[model samples]
Target: MSASRRTEARLLSHDEQQLVRTTHHPAIYEHGLDALHELRRRLRALRDRERTLLHHKMREIRGKAEPRGGSFPGLADHPGRRRQLFAQALKRVNAEASRLARMTARAVIGDGARRALALRKTGEQWLRPAPSPSPAPAPDPRPRPNRRGKSHIPGRQVGSVSQANRRAQAARDARPAPPA
Candidate 1:
């Protein structure tokens, strides 16, 4: 009888090794599956919530279209009142839709965050550390002066206020008095 020898296969790189391990390791695979499952759950819940919100919105719109009271003798006959009610109802529905859109967007963003966290915990090193705060900006070297230029007003000599006051009085006297 002849004995046969078996050879082991070698992985080309660290990434290949990690990939092989992830596929073969039961614990790692379970964690990864769990993360995926959680993501699906979150997506399903978001969908269900959106559907429920849409249904409620439709019900509200329908309720608004229906008159509250029995056919009135005079008030129901007014065309303006009906138009106003319709306008108000449309506004309310638009507002509700806008609110629901914002909520849906937030849910999607939250799911993305969760997925990012999962990816990070799973040994994915794509995320880099935040850069250290730029070294406190070097202190500016230029020296600041304590005070600005001369305090005296430009183009006027010192003690010129008296001359300005006398000129103002002469101009006032030159103007004719208003009719009595």
Candidate 2:
């Protein structure tokens, strides 16, 4: 962080402290944390909204720039130029939104601002378009051996009782009941 940013952070922290002192309510810190989270959420939402709007404007520009059928033979390149202009506009808007989000994060988030920034950066990195997947490896030609021995049965029937146990239970039940 730059010196100016450090000073600004300190000032914000001081202000936050003052606010906490004035409130004097139990769970004030929890409330403050909630407020910080809400601020971050709102900023991110605003960025998303701005990005969507820019995308829409880009589409509109593309539509307008395109020449109609049987319109003009020499004007085909105009659409490309217009498209470039719209793309630049979109980029500028996205950049400004990012800057504003950074400022808001710096101002609203206190001690954990650095962590939050790092998390945001990682999140953005994660959201980037994924690279093409590698080719699947060839399956092994050799058949896999069963780990269990012959005694081990695959997919045993549910509630199946052993023959020996059944016989033993039957014998015990068949025995004459002892006089109570």
Candidate 3:
């Protein structure tokens, strides 16, 4: 790929970055992450295409490299040259992928920082102790009007294990004895 196209594929346009920062956008979207995804998609296609070309076009490329009737040409299928070429391509792909990862990480950190700042600002409001009108009043000695009922027990708690055991024992006592 050309230098310009390579850069474009790996990074968002300047205008995109500006829009992201300036607009009231949803939290889920990010230009850098989108770029990274696109880059990966394009890279996958590129690797597949390049692999196909390497298999199909090697002979054609080697033929073009053949020495004509006049001038001398280097080895048409030099093992060293072929290895170096592919190594260089692999290095470039690795570098590009690494660059995209770093950029995405930076974008994520920045987004997290912005969110934390917003949370801090909002938290500050809630953090300030709410102003109570006065000291908390003492409790009344009398029970509340609604506290009485046939369903309510004074001290023993409902749903206790002991309550269950007592009920089971009472039920056994009430049942008639089994025939001898």
Candidate 4:
């Protein structure tokens, strides 16, 4: 079988796949049936939401457009104008909804492509061995004492200031005096 053909291909819910078969116009072509199904689901949900909102708006406009119980001749024509305006507004709403669907489809397709590219990059980076860091400069070899005298005698306490001073004075005394 060709690499593109899937022997074990599964349909997205047997009934829903047919409903979602159509590709979105002006959207990047999706390769997987699952992706197409998902896009269709999203578009349907968006359309449903828009429809609900538009229905509410139409109801509100209708409420505002009803003629009162007055017998005025001029008032009779007002409802007709209102109906015409409502129809125009409904058309606008539908146009906006279609635009939103197109934009959503485009965004979804783009994001999927970007994610795939990032995943490929990550896989490539992971496959390559990381460069070895340069060896750090060797640390100083001098011995360091912890708050004690330089002598390595165990258990010796050498933190006293007076004792250090006395040791220094005796060392100075033992040295021959500088020639006059």
Candidate 3, residue 124: the lDDT equals 59
Ten contiguous residues with the weakest lDDT in model 2: 1-10
**In model 3, which regions exceed 4 Å deviation?**
1-76, 124-180
Predicted candidate 2 versus true structure: per-residue lDDT over 46-165, tens digit per residue = 345445544654676688543334543442324333333333333433444465568768777764777668878777553567866988655766768998777554556433567668
Please give the lDDT score for candidate 2.
0.47
Which candidate should be chosen as best, given lDDT against the real structure?
A: 3
Tens-digit per-residue lDDT, 1-180, candidate 4:
111112111312333223333332333243244554455455455445445444555665689544334453432233333333333333433444566668889999999999879989787553567767978644766756788656674445656767899999999999998999
For residues 1-180, write the lDDT of model 1, one tens digit per residue.
111111001211344233223322242324333443443354344335444444544565688544434553442233332333323323433444455568779999999999989997997877787877887655876767878777767666665898999999999999999999
Q: Write the per-residue lDDT of candidate 3 for residues 1-180, one digit (tens) a residue.
A: 222323332333354323222221332133354553554455455445445545544555677544334532332233333333333334444455576688879999999999889988787553567787987665766546875566656556655778899999999999999999
Q: Give the Å error, residue 30, model 2.
A: 35
The TM-score, computed over Cα atoms with residue i paired to residue i, of candidate 2 is 0.24
TM-score of 1: 0.28
User: Which candidate has the highest TM-score of all?
Assistant: 3
Q: Score candidate 3 by TM-score against the native.
A: 0.30
The runs of at least 3 residues in candidate 4 whose Cα sits more than 4 Å from the true structure, single-residue gaps closed, are 1-68, 73-75, 124-180
lDDT of each: 0.48, 0.47, 0.50, 0.48
Worst 10 residues of 1 by lDDT: 2-11
Query: TM-score, each model?
Result: 0.28, 0.24, 0.30, 0.28
Which 10-residue window of candidate 4 scores lowest in summed lDDT? 1-10
